[model samples]
Target: MNEIISGEKILVTGGAGFIGSNLCEVLLDSNNTVVCLDNFATGKQENIAPFLKHPKFSFIQGDIRNLEDCLLATKNVDYVLHQAALGSVPRSIKNPITTNEVNISGFLNMLVASRDHHIKRFVYAASSSTYGDSQALPKVEENIGKPLSPYAVTKLVNELYADVFFKTYGLETIGLRYFNVFGKRQDPNGAYAAVIPKFVKQFMQLESPIINGDGTFSRDFTYIDNVVQANLKSLVASSTSVNNVYNIAFGDRNTLNDLVVYLKEYLAIYKPSIEKVPVIYGSERVGDIPHSHASIQKAKKYLNYQPEFSLQKGLQEAVDWYWKNL
Candidate 1:
């Protein structure tokens, strides 16, 4: 929290969405004047409603695909936390054109605007999916494989564009490759909703959620708070080189079955019958990674990032929030 540079003007690209809204809240709490630019395509209005009246909070309902929106939102902003992008590997497979248009084209637009405005640092969301089919257990930044899906390609392209912006245009940039980030306000109703929230919702309804691929596929389930820490560190720290990418994760892996167990355990406090809920196994979805893990050495050594929430700790908090809010 002390890392925040008070009074600095920060623009968060997807300010009405899950990760972006959390970033805006933290930045505003730190006394930074924050501007949010979102088109509401996937970002919900309810997510940003709490901050609509804040003195330091400004909202611009705009699309990143349009360069004019980027320029207007970035004007006079000191830093840009670029979190606006279409997510979900399955969704991208179904619609690559839209994903490319938003993730890649829109990302370039933000970079151009940030460069023109001379922003201090451009911290954008990268993805663990960039690892693709590499078969690496603890994913390192340098190692990667051919992207398995359009979504992976888009995120990887973001890293490339950020690197080019820093080298060619001299815009300082850092990319955080997030791993299975989950927390409150994350949309759980969508077809592409993340596993944790989706399962939480299903269990709340006393319904069984389907687990893909025998429930053995594991992921480094990072908590959103840890991701927030990484973003804040990258925004304020000069420890790492510009145009770099680091894995933002809990540095621990959990199987889908393991995740359900935790959710039931925590959620049972509110809905006693949820503990008896069952999960069915379905055929593995195409473009799904078998197992994923991350080595946080780079972020730790460079940005001094110390993840504050473990999977269990984050689940406790998330379950509590969902029970009260849902």
Candidate 2:
């Protein structure tokens, strides 16, 4: 992957959350002066505690919903990796008002701040959930269906705002449509926890994981490292007009059943008896997309996104983390 300019001042909104925290660490390692902005509404302090002592890292406890906080966090920043937003379809379904307040309104606040600061580029987290109800196997950037839940709507609005910001204000922006991203620091305890981490935690505890469907539903399951690479490439891409969206994924599909089997195998190294922990079938989740896969050709051609970790390889690392951390 191409490297972002070393020592560039970068502001990472929501840098205390799963994907954001991971991105901040990578950016710091690349020798950038990183500023992390988060309100801890959903972000965890422990996620960013390790970097507190790093000379290149600075933390700003703030909310994107507040324009002043956004301005404070982004002052003199060269680039903005806008990752702050409320996530979870079920949660959005339960309470879309709050999701929109955070995901949409807060996003607008950040864009205004980034525009005012004249940041070099703005790369924000878009989602596969934006493909809602579109039965296409390999979701492309151009084609999109109506959003199924409020969360999908929130993510879709980010893309729309990003495109408009680039066109109207001449601010360069790129949206990465991530598909099923998972890794260390991705919280596995919440009611809205992701499948991989949640399953790994359950298996480690000798508890049967509840699959939300018949184990046929599948996803691309992009690893966090690949996502971090995508963010880096987005920052350094040289195209004249980057007002576009790229699907960041490994471009491989695996059924939920396949995922559990691999998790069992990998976790068996830590606890030999975990292989026997069965997965219980439950009714499919409401508004759940039956299958999700991605076409990474666009990202590969434009952003030089070459994913190195497959599902099994990433799962092994995640299992190792949950084994020791949990």
Candidate 3:
């Protein structure tokens, strides 16, 4: 197994966002110098507020769409956790041009900068949506289907670009196909808010949480900490594991109904009435997969990514957080 990388300068591109900020916090805790670059379009100021005072933490207000900003952020950076991209399938469907600009062109810019700066490794956030329209129960890294959405297309392009960079330019790149990641600091007010945080917020305010489907659609709902661990492991993974992608997930499946039941069970501790809050079902979303469960065997074999939090454990943690913080 590879040891966790620490005590070096690292760049987290979306360090003000939920997953990136958590990575920033963990990197800082591990005695690393963290340079955060975020444009604050979707990333929040409060997400990184605590680290503003830290001596090793630095923030740069910049966009990945600009090559100059990418160049600036990668300077003197040992590793790059490239998380800055316009996320959401709906958002991409609504505005594919901008999504392409940020996720594809911007990703290329980051790759160019990383290569130019001679960075050791480039690890980025890939998506399960790349497994588009496939009937595969457990998604594998090598066996990907066609992209179902514009967002999925962008992610697929990112992987292709990464592979080219590694094979052609010799820039070590690792892609993490993140499942439905949810935890503290994930935005709950936006139209593109992730389901877990959005549901938690709605239930907290006594509003009915809406499920997009009949609650039977299942997902490999991964926790933020598991993702954080995957990122850390990617940083220190051996050279053989450098230029491949891994499924960063808990390797378990849960339905929307199961999620709601767990949420009610956990949130009931703070507000007993939340348990009585009815769930409203609506039409299933477009470009939404019926089921998404990852085979984390590849990740375990290569990155040694052992996810510490199960769905219930992580949901309880997230609920406790929202109850106190939301």
Cα displacement (Å) at residue 40, model 3? 0.3
Candidate 1, residues 1-326, lDDT tens digits: the string is: 44656789999999899999998899888889999999998889999999999999999999999999999999999999999999999999999999999999999999999989999999999999999999988999999999999999999989988888888988999999999999989998889999899999999999999998899999999988899889988987883556799999989899998999999999999989999998999999999999999999999988888998989999999999998899
lDDT of 1: 0.92
What's each prediction's TM-score? Answer: 0.98, 0.98, 0.99
Candidate 2, superposed: residue stretches over 4 Å from native: none
lDDT by residue (1-326, candidate 2, tens digit) is 56655779999999999999999999998899999999998899999999999999999999888999999988999999999999889999999999999999999999999999998899999999999999987888888898999999999999999889988998899999999999999999989998998998899899999999899999999889999999998888887529999998899999999999999999999889998987899998887888899999989888888998899889888878878888
Q: Each model's C-alpha lDDT?
A: 0.92, 0.91, 0.94
Clashing pairs in 1: none
Clash count, one per candidate: 0, 0, 0
Candidate 3 lDDT over 1-326, as tens digits, reads: 23667799999999999899999999998899999999999999999999999999999999999999999999999999999889999999999999999999999999999999999999999999999988887898888888889999999999999999999999999999999999988988889999999999999999999999899999999999999999999988889998888888899999999999999989889889999999999999989999999999999988989999999999999998888897
Q: For residue 43, give model 1's deviation from the true position in Å.
A: 0.9
